[model samples]
Target chain A: MNAQQLCDRYAAGETEFVAAPLGGFNLAGADLIGINLTRADLHSASLMFAYLSRAKLAKANLSGAKLSGANLNQALLTGANLHNADLHGASLQGADLRSANITLATLLDANLIEADLRGTNLSGANLTGACLRGANLREEKRTYSSSLTGAILCNVDLQGANLKGADLPRANMSGANLREVNFRNADLSEANLSGADLSGAFLSEANLSGVNFAGALLTGAKMERVLMTEADLTKADLAGALLIDARMAKTQLAAANLTGVRLNRADLSRANLKNANLTEAEMIETYCARTDMTGVNLTNANLVRAELSTAILTWVEWRGATMPDGSEYRD
Target chain B: MSVQTSLGAIAQTFAQHNNALRLRKLIFCACTQRWESDRTRLEQQPWPQLLQDLYYRYPNPEALGDAIFGVVKQLNRQGEYSRLAQIILDQLTPLYGENATETTQFLTEQTQFFNEETQFFAPTAPHLDPDDPDTTTIITIAANLNAMEQNLRMRKLLWCLRHNSWENDPQALLRIDLATLIGDLQQEYPTREDFKQALGQVVGNLSRRREYEAIAASILEIINPLYHAMFSPDPNLGDALPPVVMVMEQTPAATTIQSLETEVHLQTAISPPDLSEFPALDFLKSDNPTTTEYDLKTSTNFTPAQPPPALQSPAVKLPDYDRYGVRLAVMKYANPLRAKILAFSILNHNFTTDSHEWSSLRTQPFDDLLRLLHEEYSTWDHLVEKLTATAAQLEAPAESTQAAEAIAKAMKPYYIPSR
Candidate 1:
């Protein structure tokens, strides 16, 4: 059916177009609200600027479709195949995309706010500069965690997004605005978060091994028990961040600002803290075996009961610093 | 532009597009879509010269071969093909072959006739001679049906009507008057079907006078060629789709696009293994998830219809056509089969379940259907209804048939008979 015919029929209250062969169709700027096109062959179709809000397209073949600037808000796209689809700048706010195969689709600068994306396959998809604030990527019972492996999330504004236990290993999230993003128990290992602002982000118990946080703003971030082995925090601002019991073996913390940061009982073995400002940082009972603390400023910092014996402390400022011996450093 | 200028343009374009591969598509297109006489004309010419003529005639190989064939058809119908071909052959003898020239000289004597010839074709193709600012082109008023089609919303304004975009648009109109059924056509435009009907009515009325019949034919040529391919005894038509009045069977210009894969050299293409020239019906079938009524599972119980009387009798059948000719003609019907199926479904609504003689026609593989249509149901109007209804559906509310219709339209002159 043509767009106009479909619209006319919709006006007459007939809406189901299940499995329609509408491939290569141009429905640009059309208003197709609430249409049920389940299992429709929409490959290579152009729905650019089309209003498909609340549309039920579950299991639709949307591969290679051009849906740029389309408003798919609250649309049900469960089990839909959107591989290789270009949804650049499209909005899927509050949409239910559970279990959809969206692999390699380009969602560049798209608005996916509060969308239910549980169990979606987003591997290699470009979500660059997208806003997924309040979006759900949590692993629910009977539904696998949404896989975002190899996703390009560069400069994305994911503030307040719920990514609890989502598989996001190796995702590129450089320069992203991840403030208050819930990463509880999520896998973010080897992910790029360089220059990202993660202030007040609740990242407790997240797997952050091999992650790059160079020049990132992690002030007030909750990283309790995070597996941060081999992570790069070079020149990062982690002031007042909670890193209690975090695994920091071989982590690069060179020239990073950790003022008033808590590293209580955290592993710092073989970690490089060269030239890092650790002023007033609480490092009580922290493991510091063979750690490079060269030129590090530990002024007024608490290192009580910390293991610092084999640490490289050359040129480290220790003025008013509490030592492992329960006495203050006089220099 | 002069003949030399046109030739220079051709030569320049040829230099840029000298793949020799591009010509294979052009030649294949020409060989496929051309009328019998046109095909014969192409066959008579040497390959290099034919390549040059085709390039100079159309230029864009990527375009539909139908358009290329359309130009030749128009020229041939005007009886101008023989005249033009003889002159081109005589004058361009020195330009190609073993004794060829690098630079071509101006055909000064033929330039006048060429410029005059360019004027008649101005409405047909306004896209030529664009770079020549020094030349003054002849202007003619033509009915641009395309522009009129776009503004289908305007009540009677069948006129994209000088309201703009008319110059670039092809708009030379032959005003056919049915004594004033004209109905203020500029205010309330009729559907294209209606317009065609009115034109046919006007032309039919005027055909009584022998002198005006030529004008009548010219006006109707826009709606012509619907039955031309079927009835025009194109070379060795044989028993392959005998002349039926309304049957929209294979046309001479019906070439399958396996156009150029380098993989489809005639050696493999001619292998009579039902190679399924036009495949991929997965997208064409209406996969209505709500209804499993059209599934192929029901195809098993269907008893095949008895073979047609003509096929059984073998009365007055002509000599055998070469494999390529048979394949080309057979390939035409199968390609349009997609359009036919979609159009058929829309018309026959319960086409899958209906217990007609042609029951389960849609369920069969494209190859089987082609064989059935070729060997048995060749003369049935039920088969012919594919084209007619496909044409009619173009005017209907369902426009998903547009792509299929367009592909079919390009290969054939669209005519939905008055019924």
Candidate 2:
């Protein structure tokens, strides 16, 4: 049926429509609530502003369709192919999109709150400014996709994804793979990144106050000038990482890997770095007063003009290391 | 004798000059050493208290800042002292002036002194208190050591938890979080050895707690169902019996007693009963029995089946019954096959299940029943395709026939006269 006929029928309480020769049909602004057009061939159709709430379009071919401003609340689109579809400003709240193909789809400004998107293919999708708050994107295989805070991608993939400036505060990204991702200037306060893979990630100037990075991998990562007051980086791997000028007051980096790392000019007052690997690390002019660096590795490391006055350094390896008073470790 | 008195006076003057320089050097050395050793104790004291003590001791900010800088310089040779130095500088800056430039310069020059005295400072040098025991000094030392031990224990606890360090010894970390062993170590340890022992205990405790938490989390999955069942109120007490028990109690018998008795009596009463008295024997007498049997066999053998129905037969008709009655019948039957097919067609064709074609059957309340049937059909059709396919595959032919018969019967009651 043509778009006008379909709209007329829909307005008359006839919600269902089996479009004939369905390619490129423009149904913009049509009200087709609770329609079941499953497995229909609607390729490249323009469904912009369509009311498709609670519709069942599972396994349907809607590739390259424009569904902007559509209402698809609680719709079931499992295994449906939505490749390259324009879904901007759409409401997909509570939709079941498991195993659906949404590759390269544009979902900008969409509301997908609490939707089940598990196992859905979202590779290369532009979900910028989309609201996916509490949406389950866990184990959903996505690649090179961009999901921002305006996107509410809390508890989403972010694992190994480049999420520079993504506002993920209180996001349940615990156990997510965030290795090598850029988080510069991101607000990650109270984000659950426990056991997440953030090895070598750049968090420079990021606000990580109260963020939980316990058991997270931060090896070789740069946290320079980052606000990490009260952050939990316990057992996090920070080997060879840079914390220069970073504020870690009351931050817990206990048993963390700081081997050959740089903490120069960083404020670590009252911070816990006990038994941490500081082997050959540069702590020049760093503020570690009252920090517990007991049993830390300081072998051949420089502490030039540093203030560790109250730092716990019992049994700390100071072999060949220089003290702040022009005294060698042995002396 | 006069010459001896003059020589004694010259010797005394030289001794006094020599003693003055020696005393100054001794004082300088003693001050530097005290500064180096006092830092550890000073850190443990409250910042305000420590600052007050430093100010009282030096009276002059410049001199106090210089002493602090001197200690900083000594540790700076190792390159690891820069952090601590900056802290000291920041803390002292509010109290002391930017006149720290001189002290900074002196530190740079003295950096080589640390390298030269490498062997003099023993690694095992007992961190001892001054001979003149002061309560403040003792308290500060104890606090510093305690903080250090606690910090170490915390580190070890985190390490064990993260690495799954107790995988082989699950109880190791569990005890730590439970017993707050780290906090305890901070209170109990005095020496490095004591600290080490406390740390070990803490680690073991932590491992134990970790194990407990993991096990508890896993056990939650198993307990959830039992917990729900125990707490939930039963709505249907009559249907509470298990399905298998119901089936066992209602099993049907293989044969009826009446049929068995009839067969036995017939077999015993007559050895091939008299044919003349039988009602069917009269008709047989008029015909040739041998030919009749032969003709009947020939007719059965000669009648070949008509060609099988077409794959897409339009004649596979929907009954012209009252839509509501047929729908109600379908619902009552709860036949999934018919419901699925009907729902599929309605959704695919964009037609209501209550349409003329479906409601023409003369069934009761055709309209409402059709709506209900349509809903039920739609609901079932919404399942995943794989599940639908499996359901279709498992359906028996007899069940399909039974469903078709029910629909036909429901439609029969609503037939309208063709105009």
Can you write out model 1's per-residue Cα lDDT over B1-419, one digit (the tens) per residue?
34454556544454354443333333434545533211222234555554555545532111223344344454312233323332232233222211111212211212344355554421222222323221111000011111122111111122222121111111122111111112233123333223333332222221111212222223223222222322342222211232211111111112121212122221111111121231210011112211101111111111121223332353444433222122223222222233334434433342321246232432332222333333321222333544445444443223324424343333222122211
Per-model root-mean-square deviation over C-alphas: 28.3, 34.9
| Model 1 per-residue lDDT tens digits across residues A1-331 | 7766766787788889999888988887677899999999999998876789999999999999988657798999999999999877577888999999999998875668788999998999988756677788887752488899999988677778888888899999987878899999889999999988899998899999999998799999999999999999987889999999999999999878798999999999999998788889999999999999987888889999999999999877788899999998874
Kindly report which residue stretches of model 2 are placed more than 4 angstroms away from their true locations once superposed: A1-156, A159-162, B1-419
Best by TM-score: 1
Query: Global lDDT for candidate 2?
Result: 0.49
DockQ of every candidate structure: 0.00, 0.03
Task: Write candidate 2's Cα lDDT for B201-247 as tens digits.
Answer: 22223212222222222222212222222234222211122211000
Candidate 1: list runs displaced more than 4 Å: A1-8, A141-143, B1-419
- Residue A109 miss distance in model 1 (angstroms): 1.3
* Cα shift from native, residue B233, model 1 (Å): 99
- Tell me what TM-score chain B of candidate 2 gets against the true chain B: 0.14
Candidate number of the best DockQ:
2
